[model samples]
Target: MVGRFTRGLRVVDDSVDVFRDNPRLAILPLLSLLSIGGAFAIVLGTALRYGAVSSVLTSDLLQYAAIFVAIAVSSSVGTFFNAAVVHCAFQYFDGKETSVRGGLAAAWQVRRKIALWSVTAATLGTVLYIIDENFGALGSLARVLFDLAWGLLTFFVIPVLVLEDTKGLRPLLQESGTAFRETWGESITASLGISFVFFPVGVIGLSVLGWAYLFASGVPALLIGSAGFIVLVAAMVAAQVLGMVARTALYRYAVADEKVGPCAGRNPETIFPSD
Candidate 1:
């Protein structure tokens, strides 16, 4: 277990190195968040202003439609940017410099696939949301399990879509699962490694907030807490980008049988040791 943890840290380090080399990879997720958030805010504001939310909630079809819209918007934006990030990672792997514009262009080239996937994912997400919201504890448990399975199955979907010619949802999903299973052990450890590195940063941020609350007051405490919050959020964003970079690295090894950047010339076992 300790060995695996140590290796996970190495994976995290490799991912961080990728980030340092192409910091613009960070911009993809930031744009995703901003686009999704802005869309939600606008939709919610318009819905509330027009008093449409209550009516939508009262009607089953309308409720599902609303849920679908929400899921589709967020998932579409996220999937697009995720593909962009993966594209940039591949560029790095190919010994080329990466840029935000290049990533966006690569992602834009596959806009149709992105749309289809967004709809499919949103449909499933809407169904899951309904089951979780209406079926009590058992439904919630089922939803959790389904979500876990879905997450694993689609683990490499972004990279597959970005790099491979596999078309249609079924083929895309199958290829993603295939790639993930090819590197299941490494995939699990990579996540653990990333968490191991970022967990301490999160704790320090929380500790700062605690200190501010206990030993400071008023404007000083507010400022301290705000700083802590920013640190926490930054850590979260960095962790997310790190996860993307790690996933891209794993995909390259698993699918392309090529390792580049910090992952080059390293044994897979040593980089992602089994517990």
Candidate 2:
């Protein structure tokens, strides 16, 4: 197995290839729409069932806990689905036949690793939250640093776990390290590029919607709000799709450059014959 530090370095450089390839762009919007809709429905249902929103606003601790749990579960499922979609995109990018069925099957094959990574991420996030809430000024600074480091370091964990069928912390760490070292700069650049394109459009659209909402009332509000919501949702879906595509491109690049292990199944040459 490759060392974590080396893998991290490779990931950084591979990010450039990921963005350039744009492997999963075509399917991202559909996947994003499904994920968002599913997540919304789950969260909304939980809120209605337990009056979570009202209770949380009223500062009820128990209600807040329940709401948090609901949100976490829903978000987890959404993430799993998204991971599956990205995995499928990788398969397709590698010139394999990829359908939703194949993606789900692949996801199931590595569900344990995905779940472990998710749990680990959630725990780390909770720890940071707790430190931020209870600690002094220095503690807060430490939390920020922790998050920043993890954010950069763990960028490739999903791709590694899902695409490579990697298990345990060791593989995850190794792949993440390789990805970071090889492609961090490129990944950051691609993210910035995507943000630059999407953020301005979102801001302008939202600002216009806000003004229209303030000026309108009754049926007009309904009409304009509905239209704005649709547009915003569409934009969000597009952005997510673009992000997945970019990430996929970066992952393939990292794999190629680092000559990391073969993907989940099949012989190495089947995917990259020259290797």
Candidate 3:
């Protein structure tokens, strides 16, 4: 019942500290982004060139199936790097030496688990999206609520999967759900606070960059858009990294019964203070 926003912010600060301690941990996420984006572009280009779009637009089955595959791939890649980040963060928390390559190697060792979990998660996610797309207003609202709950419940799944390779999706999901049930306040605030702080900045920066399209010709407009996109992506990457690191710190505290880092040293109530 310790739902303190201030405590959550402190957890966030601890995560930033971890990132500062080992900035290379963030590189895996960047690579993950590039890989996912490349896969998406390849699929889209192939689909368009081969007239898959003709069927996709007309057939619900095709559309939903395509959505499932794309999301599954993207989730798998994203989860891979996120798990990698968690592993690296653990090293940071332990005061052990680690690198992005080492983290990637650890994550690679459990690639199959990551893929399985990603598929399971992606299936649920795709179903939610389909419901939202087809069910009109009610589906949209349901999707919003469902997505939030799903995110909360599975927030620790990647870290769990990385740390405990023997555990299957069911056990990992259960552990993730249980961890959040116990530390819901700190977990929710860590992510929510970051989003609340960065979303506006991203919006404002994009708006300024978007304005370039109005006044600049051709290449300048492209440059402005690309610059804006990079900034936005960088913000998102930072947010995800911080959240994952905080979650790592929490996981160690909650499950491992070890409160070694700054993140765990702080009280839960202070993270998001009632005041």
Please provide TM-scores, in order, for all candidate models, with all chains considered together: 0.88, 0.71, 0.89
lDDT (C-alpha) at residue 207 in model 1: 88
Give the top-scoring candidate (lDDT): 1
Off by over 4 Å in 3: 1-5, 218-223, 262-264, 269-275
- Please give the range of 10 consecutive residues that has the lowest summed lDDT in model 2: 259-268
Candidate 2 yields a Cα-based lDDT of 0.61
Ranking by TM-score: 3, 1, 2
Best of the two (2, 3) by TM-score: 3
lDDT of each: 0.86, 0.61, 0.79
Candidate 3 residue lDDT tens string, 1-275: 33444555666677778788888876888898899999989988999899888899999888888888988998889888988898888887777898988888988999988888878877988899888988999999999998888888887887788887556777888988887776676667777766766677688667757787677779888888778777777777888788788788777766765764545655654544423
Ten contiguous residues minimizing lDDT sum, candidate 3: 266-275
Ranking by lDDT: 1, 3, 2
